[model samples]
Target: MARSQAQDVIRCQYCEDEPAVFHCVPCGDELCPRCKVFHLKSKVPSGHNIVRLSEKLHPTNQVKMCVVHSYKAYEACCEDCQVPVCIACIQEVHGKHTIGKLKDLYERQKAESEHELTKMKGQYKSEIIQRIKYFKNGEREIKTSHKNIREKMKKQAQDFIDHISAILTEALDESTRDEREKLMEISQYRAEAEIFEQNLEQLIEKFETLTESSHPADLILYRKQNPDTFKRFKFPFKINLTLPSYTIGHINKTQNEHQFGKFIRGHISHLTLWDDSLQAKYLTGFERVKPSTKKVSGRSLKISETKTQKGELYHVSCRDDRSAFVSGQGPGIQLIDRSGTELDKISTDWEPAGLAVMKDGSLIYSDYDNKIIYKVSLKKQKKIFINTDYGPTGLCCTKSGDILVCMHEILFSVVKYNSSGRKIQEFETDQNGRRLFHGPWSVCENINDDICLSDFSIFNRVVVLTKSGNFRFTYDGNVLKQKLKDRFNPRSLATDSLGHILIADNVNNAIHLISQDGDFLSYILTEDDGISLPHGISVDTNDNLWMVEENACVKVYQYLS
Candidate 1:
């Protein structure tokens, strides 16, 4: 285009005549409408950004300045360092690093940053907020519980004081009556002495009269009337006014005893609501599933078997590699090593059925014949821990050292007792007031402290109860689909460190593994695994499952792997 140039008029640089319409960024030239089109179409400055002259003073698409080099704008992004760099930084600090165009890099980085921020706000931050709310509610509940306990204790203290006061009043009334009786007795004796002195004076006067010949006949008659009285001088025995001793009673603070008029310390347990590994798996969106090993599997667990001379292994409890106790129709509970060698035999009063080991290396076993559970210490000292009306079938020592026993015959219930043999709680019926288990053969506590019972009756299932004795759920072998002919009779139960409940399915001759919350996981061992009619099951600290089979043998299976 041909145009005339005027310096004072601020005309288009290309036309050199008309006023500027737009500013060309790359060419740095003000152009009219025709010249702006020519500038956009020009091959030499093809990438120039054109802006309207009105918007030239305020550009919205201005590039950010480099923080390191204040005067320079970022031209490229270092892929290695993931940072934008100016021309000066590219050659100095980010030299030799793979570079990407600054615009493209900005778009990519913004998307990634936004993605992470959204996840933080939606999942992580939201979870934290929810946890905070839970903690707040728990705090309020704890405070209310403490207050209630305090009020109850106060009432009990007042009742105790009232009882003592009544006793004191009753004793004082009896003591006062004794003192009044003694005073009465003294007054009666004084009056009798006065009468006796008058009588003596009368007799003396009569004698003097007799001497004066006034009443010889009267004196003789008085002596004749007093003959019976002179036979015995009647006198009240010395009043022994001894009252029963009274002392002010006070509540004695005995050790480990329920103390009155005192506050018991309250505590809040630590909360571990969610697993971090599970959370990570959920966020990454990529599930790395393990190889399927469910049907017709091989040696997933290393198995070892041992047969005892007792010929019948009904129950087994493993504390450590050195101390795994087994019981049956044996003379005593046998403490066996991992190699199946009997380390010691604890003599029993009756045939042993259920066995459990305490945290202090002591053994607690149940005698089915006598309906007694005995606690045998490492020092050979034994004491009867509990005696149930029904036969005790299975028993387990909880993490808190409480013993949970499963009663078999009439009362099919799970009873919990402290280490000192005091019954803490009992779970007979479920939450809806229905019977929980039909002939609970075995019982175990999961990692979350929930009680699991193995039932062998018609409704063969594993019944679970919460730590507080509330029913949680029941597993009825529905999760593990087996043949109809093979019943779902669970003989014994055990739980690993991971909270997976392992039950010995007797009819199926397998070990059924279920999640802590009663979700069926998978079968650990099947009939193909050579486990025939598995009975008692126990898991050691190393997560090794020890099982007693009806074939008169004990099998050890390493399950943690």
Candidate 2:
């Protein structure tokens, strides 16, 4: 590198020389500072931005080039070789190499790069817009799905407020009664005080009049004391009623007129759905799950699907499905047509919860809440025996007519009672240490004597146990995939004659269908007429469904098949 006091370092327009002069008036040659030509004619362009060879041009962003010669002006890149090339080297090296014009090459490439950057920026903008749309739409759908739940929660809160108000109202009434008693006592004392004050005032007024009298004859006559007039001056003690504090409603465990407690006229316990011979007749069983204990879910439930409503059913040394005893709510086991229409009502003091008519025609039932398993004779009444876990809610007569029960409360427990309600053997609760939540809501003994209980309250789980309380499988309305997590609360359980377990999905407001394994089947009612606050559910031998809503009517949905 070299420097000079003149412009054009590479060449001089007038002179062809190397180092003496940066430019020359005569044959000027672009020169470095060391190569300045002495006594050179000056032809400097005043407005030119070119730097002298003796000075650095402050590291110019404009590429270095010859100042006066337009042909030698700065250019960013060479197009033909696709590399940086200067004007002096062009003719020497790139003159015959298909060299592109420099200015044209730089302009063309700069525009192309700019276009690419614009295209990429547009693509990013479109992607951001699409992503926002995706998320917002998904959020709306999820919120809509729980629309009813929000309303339900608000209603529940209001109902809770009302319940608290009712408690306060009761307390306010009690306070009023107490205040009235005290007010009555004060009223009597105040009346006596008023009488004493009136006598003293009268005596003081008489002394004042006597002191002002001039003579005895001039003295005013004493007025008569009238007790009736004084009595009218009394006023009773009265005060505003006191307000009472609010109370939250809690479970009232005490016995009251609401028909709660053990005296029980009709309380639902073990309920089950069974399919008998006909599709028209399905069975729902109810059993006295516990004899001495007073709790629901202990009663066993079983119903026999009869073929025809043609005869009053009894253990007619029963042939096939012809004469089967049924567990029912109505007093007296009413003999019914296979359709459950009453043919003749048979009276029995025992409100049987679980009922099974044996092959040789011995009728078996769990007495009034899975308390005592019994053998009933339509011709005679008798208590066969006692057996079960806290009480049995489901009962099924085996091909051998031995009773299998799905127990309540304790986990993985189900007992089998012989025809005489005697505990032939006990199946202890020894499963995978998985005990049922709360007591069992309901239970079912499938034809195989495998037990299943609709268990779990806070944990809303349903479990199937073996005959000996071994955990075979379980479902808690939750799964890795969302599809299986919908139906969580099961109220009652039953197996159709086809061996499908029908579950009363109470919280889901539908019936859940499941295989004996943990596979979830479709729901029973998904549309409008399916269910509302479904509480207890059972299937008749005909595959018809009978369900109870909180305080709503017991609806019977008949499956035409």
Candidate 3:
């Protein structure tokens, strides 16, 4: 048995011809003396803990030697230094330090390491797996977002190309039509000239024959037969036809981008893991209030009328079921009830240009004289909301608590501000860089997040824009045709529950109801309906139309269910 065991000796892993004397723990390589030297000289890291093969095989019985005193075996562990120490090291270097038996310290450390391993295996490993899944989901979401963006961009490009092609085709067709008409006129003139020339040639040949043949009797006979032809020949008048000419429109890179639309870099959010709790919180859905499908009757039934002392009221904002805030060319804005009773009054140093009721039941008004916007709390306390560079004419509060202010005068723009008064966006021009508004009189937000405003300038149109500040369309009351008695003078617009824009045409003494897309739906109130000079308009929560006339007479009507 002893001879058989000796014959079963392991060979060197590096050199199979010789027996391995040492084992490298980190590299897991068994080597002979010569191979060991070569392995140490190779790219192996320093302090590999190479030990004798016998000690490696029986590691539990192996004695540890002190690092400082290599000749002596470790007997105690110095707690202060956190290292194993030999008898000589304890007496010399660790004389005043806390020490424990090496065997006891090893047992305690082994138990602690096992506990830590168990904890990691149970908790840390599961957490790492969950984190991996979260990151994978996030990667997929990012890929999907990028793909959608690419598709949207491609669609926009194709639409723009199609639009340009259509325009070009129309222009060519028009030019061809003009060319055909002019060519037909020229052909008619040529045909008339050819007939006249033939007649002249015939007459000349006859006269030449008569003169050359010395036949006075024949010439006299021919002249007597065609006496009417002897008169002066009549020539067709020249047609002064002008050819068509075209002037190419100059479109630079900036103008082209404006017309075709350019990319707008949106806000990018930070990346975070969507855990179960986060998913439960964010993935939940809520009910949305759908817009009404009822059509406008074009005839509103007058419900009640409240006459206010404020002369020529310019604005009226419904507060709730009972009261509304009204402002005019007065020193203060008054909140009045259905019975014409004053509920409250907010006195201002200057006349308020625009007034709106916020979601929190507070009143906000714009002072054009001071170029400032003030917010009045329910308790009648006033505070400065925002300072503007231009006079603010109209203002409204959105469902999200953001304020939309119409700044008029030299700069015509609608500026959006958050509750904290931070400017979020501004719409000054259309996609073609043309001015969007001449004088923005009143502003309102639709249920679809579209902005509707009345322009009180000579244009007298209602402009609509998307939430992202993109131009949608404009309504100029041309669709009304003969129905519109006077020029469309839009002022003080409001949106109904059906997302329809109702604009007051004070000059025509009518209210024009249009869709969110700027399509003229109907004239809800007209001169025939006894709505005289309707100016300030608003829609209450109950879908009731509240309008203030030029005489400061507030009228409520049931226009929609």
Candidate 4:
């Protein structure tokens, strides 16, 4: 502490009566004759610098030098070691640690300290003010409710006094719990806010001292501890308060009108403290990171009827776009547009049972009755794709322009075909050589190129396999104890845009949705969605779901939204 010569008179810090004669910078105080003698004789060290006020000199406080290498000033900070380091120390103990220049470190600490001070003074104060407003509103609500209850009690004073003790007791307990929770939240917020303000004040003071002096080494060490201090300080918890209505309590009808009834107090009914940073994130349209929890509920699948056709649709498949091709129980395959318009129909005597559509709008279907698979164009011309020894009941088109068909005779198996209708591979059993399927009725190809089959055997499960025909997992519907009371009889299978497998649970008259890895997600389409014995399931390019009922009725559903 140094006094300017322009100030003709300066009082002593301790006595405040006499003019200061000496300045003790380490103690940050000016002293008079008697106080200076006491300070020097008592606890003040002998080497402490004491300058005369009239000398126009700066007083020395403390000199910090590297202890390992004496008299050498610390030039940098070792962030990993959380200590100040001289030139020699950096080369030995902190050779691998991140080193920051003392000057740069000091500048960063000052900027951050200023930012913390501003946030606490401005944003935190505003948040606390908002909380006070909520509490005041809740108090007014309680008063209003009390007035209304008192008026009611005045009308039925004698009757209300009979059993009012029980009613008042229940209300008191409920109100105590609700109000206590809110009070605890507010108290915790106040405590945290106070701690934050205190820390900011200390940081600012430390920076101020460094700003007026050359203490870069001290700042460098302090800066290392402050980088992550405000990482979680973006949002303040909000307070929402509400007062519940109160009923009339015991009435002292025999007393004067002023004491007509004992008052029933209203408590805070809705009080919550929540962080608004998540909503703020949504406002920014965050698209880079995946959400921590997947949203799989709170959606409705709407059903709409397509154009009426003559025959019953057995199996359905959609192209790369919204157009769909349906195989019928009769001898025909019909093309339906996304909006339920019938575009074309090709009549065939083979009796198509399974269908799939390519990206080029070419239709491929299997006629199990004739043991023939046909590829038909939009022009109504057809070519024999494959003639399998086993009957092909389910068919699907792959991303690589290949075809996967489910065929069964005595034993169940799957077969893959290339674009030229040549059998590229056959998958009958799992990798462990165990029987993979009992009776697979429908097959689907997911976005990950994995195979999903809806088996209709006694087990009634969905068998899944990797792209290379490796065993994945089977969904038996046993996990759903509430939904599946009977055996899990699966009829049709399809994959949605979210990589969820949709299986038509024929026994439950609902569709079961599962993750791509075979974990049950949720039922996207159920009986509530107008599903009745859902036998065929398909998804178009627009992610719209198309399903066929057992009674020759077809329905399209808006499922994504």
Candidate 5:
């Protein structure tokens, strides 16, 4: 019976020659005593736990083996070295180190790993799913937005086509009416000529019959009855007709693109999550956050002056090249350099009532006499920009290249035109139906897109309105009455980068500065500063104030650093 039981025992998996005595937990190998010693001496990592085959525990409860002592199970862990150690290893190598039970360390690490996995599933995975849903919704919104835009585009195109069709119909109808009236007059004249021809033929037949009659008596009677009729007959005057002519307008591709609008693409970046709470713990060596600040001007300073020969400068517009376009009561607009040298000139039949320099270095001006706004290109090509019922006085170019024109006649109002010369908006009255201005002289746009104008009316106020034409506030120089000691007579208006409104007070001989909200700030330029009869003012990109005096002098000042 002993021999039979021994024969039934499991053989070693390594050598396959002797009955198994030990089992390596990590390797899951059954080995005899000799094979176990040989396996421990093999060139594998040292932490293979070997136990008696009969005493081997479940895989989950297996004892950890020390890396240095392959034959011994770990009894403790060296906290300082962060490794499991056997009792011999602790006594020999880690005797002075802080120690912890191997079982406790194993359980702690296992629990921490399980907790992290649970949190990942509960929070991180859910957050990722939410982000996916958000992207899906965004995609749907984009599709819907594109559909709406396409529909709008189609509708606008149809409207344009319809407008052109109406014009065509009107032109055809006018031409037909003119042709019908002219033909009727020609037909009436032809009928009168036919009658005259019939009468002349009847007279000639009567004369022939009398000559053939050989009766002198008959001829004499006829002559006596028609004595005055035989003298001479005059023909009707000739009718001259002129046909109507049509001139096709040239289409500008750039202006059409602006009118049609365009798509603005947004930038997309890779998504990243940052935990502020963990930043200090993980990014301790990183730089700390700092507050942002803006630089401000200390005081206003007179920079330079450019004398012009234009005579009574009415408007001044600064250019990016440090030059300026100055217009006056003279017959032309002059472009002058900072040193008062004439760079160029655009001659006009009459003085330009309003002047503005476009972003493309072109010039735009309003002709009060012609009731037209003209644009002069950089190539010196001049063309009509817009025709208005009222005379346009003061004009300015908005940041978006739109023109803000102030017109006054029976009604005082400001009109806004796009770069394509299409009228987009008009500001005439407030929400309460009250007239916003009696005479809007000079117009400008603030940095915040607010419309600021100097009203040369009985009120003598500076009107500030929102971009949508809503009433914001009005500054009538009441706050500065004590200092000015004169009636407010604002002529031209301008706005700086800081959104301060600079008004040329003609009566006070000063340029009053006010906040965008209509609060009086200060007199940035006055008689003491040599600002006399200031008519037009503008702010350049460098925050320099450019002013035009009635004496045709263009002065520049630095009010911001």
Candidate 6:
């Protein structure tokens, strides 16, 4: 690397060390770095140069007396050019032209020249900011387009596999398997290629910042002292890439090679047809017992009203162990604990539906009646997060701090939001796989970031979606019906620290705790204190269950051994 050069210093002409600017002595010669003296030089009539560094060097102030006229110093304006004259020559020179302060005129001209450098700095500062914004936005647009096309390719590949599978027969099973495997291999290769593309895009963005235009300063700025004004700007990037890499990908691959690529893949050999026997039982060890000496509530899971509201609670969410937030039935959202004690109110014109706590201690909620997403800071400042096309019903924050939102009456959609409330990406369709769960009522991100959505359309079951929104599997129908003791109308979903999925089965009036892999664990909540028709269920940061009873006010219960 080349060593950086330091800034050059500017100084006055008269004083070598003191920024001696202006002219030298009285001679009007350009001064050194800092001293304040004028050196004036004139061409004499005798063709000799007369220079005066100070007043003492003036020809009129010379020690020698004039040969013709003796006495005191003489002062007269020369008739022709107005040069200073002796008393003896004054009468001979007679009149004069214009007269001005030579030193004052020189000072004004120097000041104007110095200001030109300052004007250049102000112009560059603002210009640099606009250029930076354009570069970043361009990079973002390129990445988004790239991701969308990759998704399209994935869907095309899946369609190809499905077409091959549809003609499966006993005689062709082996061939079909081989064909499917071939497709899978192609997909794997393409997926890896997509990853490389993403990586290359990121590198390109980095390069654009590094190779930006250069800016050299006239003065060594005490940049440290003015950190805000002289903030460091990222340099323009540079990419040492070949042109072919930019055109990039299998869209350019040949048809014959593509057909041959769809053959038995190796990855399928590693996968086995999984069955219920593959599920491991949870070893809680304790013997099951009925009521009476029950550790939790022993009521017959009945629904009873503890407090009747003038209107229904639209959305109730856990704020903490002692408090929660609720929307609906009012103009705004309300904060109450498990005890139904209203601690605060968030005023709004529309009815709120769902709410969740963000990783940074902020509250995120959907105003279904208004079709807007709202965010409240820990300090209680509220702002609109997003305005959705449909009414949002479920809002959740994953362990990674991204927000997952479910909009009602819409084929299951999970839109992700960044910590700052910006929409990042959304999973809305199966262009990547199977169709999204219809009428997804609620959403939760499992320990593995596999998103789980509660679907109540035709099939009342929980649908597990891959991180990319691909349908991993369904958990319902006869198998789930036989394993469960009650109806599984999951209205809300939450994950415990142990990776168990806690689903609020509103129709059956119970909370079902299922194992991480979807094996039935046990009922965590039922009719306790005559609770029924649970509308909203949330587990606080402490994992304490806070539930909103439709027929009652609210309730909090701890699940203990």
Best-matching candidate per TM-score: 1
Between candidates 2 and 4, the one scoring higher on lDDT is 4
Candidate 2: where are CA atoms >4 Å away? Answer: 1-340, 346-363, 368-370, 378-380, 387-390, 406-412, 431-438, 447-449, 456-458, 478-487, 530-561
lDDT of 2 at 403: 68
- Please identify model 3 stretches exceeding 4 Å from their true place: 1-295
| Count of clashes, each model | 0, 68, 0, 1, 0, 49
Give the local distance difference test score of model 6.
0.60
lDDT per residue (tens digit) for residues 1-561 in model 4: 235654668889889899999876445578998898777765643234466876435211223468998755566777776577777798778998899865566566678989978976887667667667746744654565566576767665755565477777887888999889888978998887788788888867877886667578876776686666568544446567676676666756567454453453433433334354322111001122232333455675565676445566667787645566776667777777656677777888877778888756788888887778998876767888899879898988887888899997876789998877877668888757898888888998887567899878887889888666767789988475887657778899988656778888877887888877788878877777666777788987767778877667778776566
Model 6 C-alpha RMSD vs. true structure (Å) is 40.7
TM-score of 4: 0.50
Clashing pairs in 1: none
Model 1's lDDT to the true fold? Answer: 0.73
Q: Which stretches of candidate 6 lie over 4 Å from their true place?
A: 1-310, 409-412, 430-432, 477-487
* Residue-level lDDT tens digits of model 3 in 1-561: 999997899889987989988987656788899999988877742245567898685433345677887777665688888788877898898999999866567777889999978867876566667657745744654565567667867877899889989999999999999889878988889999999899989978888999898579998988888888746688867887676788988779997775554555433344343333222211101223433466576468888897887788888899986678888877798888777899888899988889898989888999897889999998888999898878998999998899999997677899999887777668998767999888998999987677888888888888888666667788888574788777888889998777778888988888888776677777778888777788788888888888888788988888874
| lDDT tens readout by residue for model 5, 66-139 | 68877777766888887888778988999999998666777777899899788778766676676677467456
What is the C-alpha RMSD, rounded to one decimal, of candidate 4?
A: 45.9
Ranking by TM-score: 1, 5, 4, 3, 6, 2
- Structure candidate 3, residue pairs in collision: none
**Each candidate: what lDDT?**
0.73, 0.51, 0.80, 0.73, 0.80, 0.60
Q: What's the lDDT for residue 187 in model 5? A: 94
Residue 242 in model 6: lDDT = 33
For residues 316-431, write the lDDT of model 2, one tens digit per residue: 11113322233334335534433445444455565545555565555655553546666556565655456554665555566556666655553545566665555654555443
lDDT per residue as tens, model 6, 1-561: 233322244444445454323433223344542233233334432222223334434443333434445652333334355344445555554434443433344345457756744644654444445445634643554565567656756876787778757745543776667678877866776777777678667756644544453233412243434455324433333334332112324554578445433332111112222323323222111211122222333322322223535266545667666677766565677776544566777787666677888877688888777778888887889888888877787988887788888876535567887666666677767645656677787888776557888886777888886555656566662344554457567787877545567777777777777765677766766654355777777767665666776554666666632
lDDT of 1 at 126: 80
Per-model TM-score versus the true fold: 0.69, 0.36, 0.49, 0.50, 0.52, 0.45
